[model samples]
Target: MNTFGMWRLARKYDKFPTPEEKPYSPFNRQEPQEVFDGTQVYSWAAGTAEFAHRGAVLLRPLPEDPAPGRWLGYKDTVRGPALDWHTDLGVIRLVHCGDSKAATDVASAITSNGNKDGVVTVCALYGDMGFHGPALVAADTAHPGIEYEASWGDVAALVGQVLPWWPDLLRLPSVIREWKPDAQAAVVEVPANDNEKILCRAAANDVFDVTSRVAATDMANSIRNNQVDHTSHEIEIFCKDGYSETPNQVVAGAVPDTSHHPLPCDGDREALKAGWHKLALHTHPDAVAALEVAVGREPNLLPFGAVTEIPVRPGTISDRWTQRLTMCDPTAAHAVLAQDDKAEAFFIGPLTDMPVLRTPGDDGKQVWRFYAPLSLPAGGPELASVVLHHTLWVITSDGHVHPAPCTPTEHLWWGDGWGDRASEAAAVVDQLLDDLGATVDLHEHWNAPKGLTALFNEEHKKGAELTRAALLHARMTPPRTR
Candidate 1:
């Protein structure tokens, strides 16, 4: 057909004549300015102001009667409530939506047409402008008046300087040091007309630029005022290279380079001799307490457990990797252990974190030796490796814990792939023990007593050996090749 004829023919059977829907187009959209009123943007701060840390604190009107709330969502080991996964992720996606659509984006919506009977209020520890997730209400019965809030990291009782609201909301809640309201105020600046571009740039990238600057300013002031005392905890560090008296902060940041520091308990050992460190935290119970306060129980790979006498609290001593090897107030006391008659000292931190000691051999010359459990012919693939830690500590009255290089008993590492090849791995361990016995004496204070040691005595070694076995198996296993 001709062009005009085809057009007419196609038009004759079109659904448009019967009023069909048309496709959407950009022209169909309306101006967003229709309901946007700057004056209508009444000052809205999410939570009540219990306290402020200068710019860190956005002063909000206090609630008439703030209700007392309990801390929740914390692991039993941690002192405070945990921060939520989203807070850790630091994701922020703002949307322009009304009450109905708002629920889709925000876990807890703060605005209501002003009928305050729905959601109960709570003071959260650390959150972005105190905005918790959507109110804890059922979808069908949820009310607009009640704002939703569920924060993980903030324990209500925790009090510290203000933290920045950012991609990730991290709060440092310790005892509040010197208040730096003046310092915080000094850094607060009104963005100049020329600084619009700078503000825009920061907005594009750093979610918490202003808050960061404010925090930095406050922190600087604290330092200048001598408030942030960078006190070092006295410790005797031992490692393969050498032993030295260093601060806790220095070694806390050491790379957990397992290759260089394969903690006897953490991985396999082929060479009977290994290099490790002894961090002399034995004398500093206050340092220990500071460490516990600083760590507050994050995820730990291995925790060496023991039951000690002081107050007799049974707990695990392990590396709190997240504390980043920090030092806290020496005055901050922690519960220390003291046996009925014996010197009670427990190994603290991760096995890999301590300093390596120079062990003395029976040969008299300086030796690189680790006294570990001797695995005799025993059943199970489990006994194929050595334990993690082999030393117990004794704190002196004078607060000086000299590193005593002790070998203690430990098993030898044999390759895996046998379920009950006790004979194979055990024989290897026996031979190692015989060699060490001939070369080094076990009766010496450096080594633990021979034969099957007590459960408490071999506990650390057992844990270490198991971890070593697992790690050894992983290392020994050949990777799949295409």
Candidate 2:
């Protein structure tokens, strides 16, 4: 039967009559009355009820250590060993309230084997025995005592004994698997461009580290296989669009003859000769100035005034003074003008300080002349043009004017190619502008005779004002937002 039915049976038989029948309430009032002490019986019944309802129950020992103990009892016929029960309360009892047949069989086995001992039972005036279900059945080994019908309440008392070894059994194997490291390779994609070319070149030369070798090789192969074909195809498609192949080397065109003769030198002849030879080889547009310097005498070889007989300094050359005249008309006039011994020599002037002007005489008048500075400008005119965004004008003594060339506008397929062209143009423009600006300033201040001094000063003032205005305008303009 179920646990509830057993509980109902226990309740019915365990009750007593009310106050009207005995003139007192047995549970709530005092009276001279007879009573039966069934605390152990009730305890067993309560345990049985618990066991029958719950299949298993945890048994916590005194010290709370999860260890095995001695068997008290089990559901009679399950054929398993009787569970061991241990607790700080000395010894505890477990009553199994399992199936009735199983309980009876267990009782018979324990009784037949004569293993039952230290067991007890209780009896009362009863008809139903207040037991409605099978529970722990203890066999009488010492004596055949009154047979008590166990209830579901008795099974609960035996739960600890029924599963005492559960904790130990559960802790058997605690091995866990270890994690393995990931070993997958990573992939990288290379973009088609000049950078790819550079990378490939670096890889070919083994300039990159070993870790990067694989990536570099892949990029190189990709460039060789795909980019090569693609570049060729693009070149073919753009061929008809006026796309010209850039020349690897630019040829120097027929430049004007602006070479200078060295000045007459009063220094050691051998040293002067060697200096002139070296200067001539390195100098452009001023070979004449160098020649005159090697001669060790004033260039005014003409029988003129005291200026012609002026004694040259120990290491000074005559052309050094004469070359200053070149700036007056750098395009055509070839004449020595006044000289400034304190002139700050820069770029190409260490060998010869003065620049002579070569004039082209036309119609019995010097109209065109080319100015050659003994020293090149500190920062060349090419760089100045890039910074200033202004064209340089070269004026000759014979009234000839030449403007520095502009950069060519051409599309380049690669950034390196474009940068190369820009750098080259910038350098050329810087050189040209430096030379022109120096020449113009030198001619205005140091050339033109004293009679033209006022006119030259006025022109210089105007040029200075214009330069200031341009600079101010640049400073005031708002920067491009983009």
Candidate 3:
């Protein structure tokens, strides 16, 4: 359908019949014109005001207090009456309906009306005014086919300044911002040969020509303002390809990238071996905080469960993968055993070369080399592969965080299968220990260690008392995957 000179934002009502049923038309609809005797079309100031953005005076009366009343077939509190402003070109009306369904039905009936020559009925669906589909349905009829469509916001953008009535209705709780006032305020006269007449004529013409470039320009501006930016505030970056005092860093935004930076425990061996920069000695709190936010937890420089004198609180370190790497390995006792007797001295050193480190990059740039626990062969697959992945984080002196790279692995892709295998292996170990209780209980004797001769004599008696042939026959087998 072509652009029309008249427009109306109306509500659907069940009492109202379609044109086929009742043959109704707003042009011929009659109302008591005696009420609008002394009331003037109120003009509100723009910029946070309801309408009148471009200093244009509103042609409609200010909405009165919404009270309990009935409109069409629905019973509810009502605002102002349905009001219409007529111009030489056409007329625009605001017909407040009882509910959203009534508003939609009224709009559909009007759009589907055969005699609606210079009329455009818009169904103002506010809830879904941001999307194109809903906007189209709101602007067009929901009958056999859609005639015109635009979201309520888009319609507001296209003619909000010129046709301020509907936008004003949108601010209220009612579906149809009604048009006609009470009987005392019904017979509203035309603008008395002033700028208001010129403005009303212009609004009528604009609403008529709404299917033109003017609407297009407004929609373009709205679309530009509604675009989404997916940039993250804090990200883990990586070292650049070449070296410099201020080496350039590459963003790892969801990309597959690896870091060659040295770990805190490995000293400079891994760095030298990988030909990357040495670990930086200091930590930047801001950078650490950013890394924590990106990784969802604070990075532990030392392995978990490592005995320390510093009175570390339990659950302070939540990274289970790093914890298991050190906790499950017997040789990792060095991390727990203190070498000095100082009050603050604890064996807090990293057991494996897996803890994250702050390493110096080219120029004054520092990179956080985060080593996640991949696999601890010494602790066996169950403990070693607890966290079979690593992430890299790089921080520069300028304090900007780069997005971290995500490198996918088989264990991460199919974790459930790996977890089941690990659980089965652990269960087997538990079963073996339970069956060989007395034989394996020798380690418990160390709490009160006797002399070597006494330990040997006790071991000899226990061994002789146990059935050697039966023990040799009993075997523990790990689960095998086909």
Candidate 4:
């Protein structure tokens, strides 16, 4: 019989004002009774009549006046549908009573709503009376939507559950940078070579290789000079010197150690002299001296015999058999050597033996050297020729090559990996090849022993009919005049 009991008693009648309505005081009453429809229906009764210090009780009017003779018994206040059990109003009304027993009874009555209907009710029981201040109690029940069913601890947990989407609800700035198409637009300028402009103009697309254009210019120059003519009587060499069956051939007379030094019996001396002159003009004197030592001769002396005919490309002698050799362009020497069938097994070898007399160190130290030919094949009687010398020896007890090693040109492109600039050059080559209607598979030859020939054979076998059809189409089409 407290505030909550009074509220329950007030809510029982259909004529009672909703809990949402404001309370009104009766003319004679000290405490206010909530009113509806201008009727003074609800009232508080002193609970001292029922139990001491229990505060006041509440009563509701009976539906019909009490039956004539029989004494009318009052029933406990019945909850109504208008009372939201999930809300804190019912709980607030119950727990605000002055007496602990009354508050406990009110809490029991609210919780009992679960049995009457599906609604579950709960109440906060403060341990200390001081904590049950009016403001604190009102604050707990202030929000209309949330019901104060349980203790503060449970309320905190409920708040956390209700606020689950709070973090997701907040606005966040984008982490990724927004790039506009126009902002990214830029012009890349390529440095020009001799024929770069011409190639770029002739290119079907805007893209062209500046370096390849230079190389093509050199090639065109060579063609003009009759150096690389298909009709030229160029000697092709197939050599097999038995040191080890390595990929690159070992140069004769290049090792300082004279063990298996090949003499300058043929055109080797002139070739050696030419290679030295070529190298001396471009390289440092110390490097030239190193080259001479590798060739088993002084820098001043020539190594080839006068009677032997010196071909631009030196032939290899395996068991006294000689053949013609085809020379590689100086700029493309490394690429040519790397792709050569004979130069695949071992990483080290001499490019040309005739022009350079290279030797291993006298003390059995490993050394290799290159000599620029005295007369370049392009300018001289020889169309194209140069010698490469390789020297191999055992390492000293300290695991170092003796007689000091010779450094090759830094500009030579021999290694597998290239920097950004070289990669761009290779890409240009690929693009040019594509435009020329050529399917250039450089890696296939690089990986296999038979090289490009083997790849061509494989492709021919696999796509013979397709290739024939392409050929037929080519024959039927008229050549376009530019």
Per-prediction TM-score: 0.19, 0.15, 0.20, 0.13
For residues 1-482, write the lDDT of model 2, one tens digit per residue: 22344445456654421122233655776655433223333324334534322211221112333343344433222333232234332222332223333323444455566544433221111112123221234322222232344332233233222221111111111100111112121111213355445444544544334433333344345444443344334323322222135211111111111122121223344443343333323323233332233222322211111111122222233333333332322210122222222122121122223232222233333222222232233332322211111122233233322332222221101112322322322233223433533322221222223222221122132112123233233334533433
Those runs of model 1 whose alpha carbons end farther than 4 Å from true positions after fitting are 1-165, 169-282, 290-431, 437-482
Q: Tell me, by lDDT, which candidate is best.
A: 2
Worst 10 residues of 2 by lDDT: 171-180
**lDDT per residue as tens, model 3, 215-318:** 22222222222221111111111212223352222222121111311112223333222211111111322222222221222112222211111112233222
lDDT of 4 by residue, 181-281 (tens): 12321111112333333322322222223332232233223322332121121111111222334221211111021222222222344444554334322
- Candidate 2, residue 230: the lDDT equals 46
> How are the candidates ranked when ordered by TM-score, highest leading?
3, 1, 2, 4
Task: Highest TM-score: give the candidate number.
Answer: 3
> Better model by lDDT, 2 or 4?
2
lDDT of 1 by residue, 239-352 (tens): 111222421111111111123121122222221011101001322332233223222321011111122111121232212121222332211111222212222222322222
Candidate 3: global Cα-lDDT?
0.25
The window of 10 residues in a row where model 1 has the poorest summed lDDT is 271-280
Return the lDDT, model 1, position 44: 18
Sort all candidates by lDDT, best to worst.
2, 3, 4, 1
The per-model lDDT (C-alpha) reads: 0.23, 0.28, 0.25, 0.24
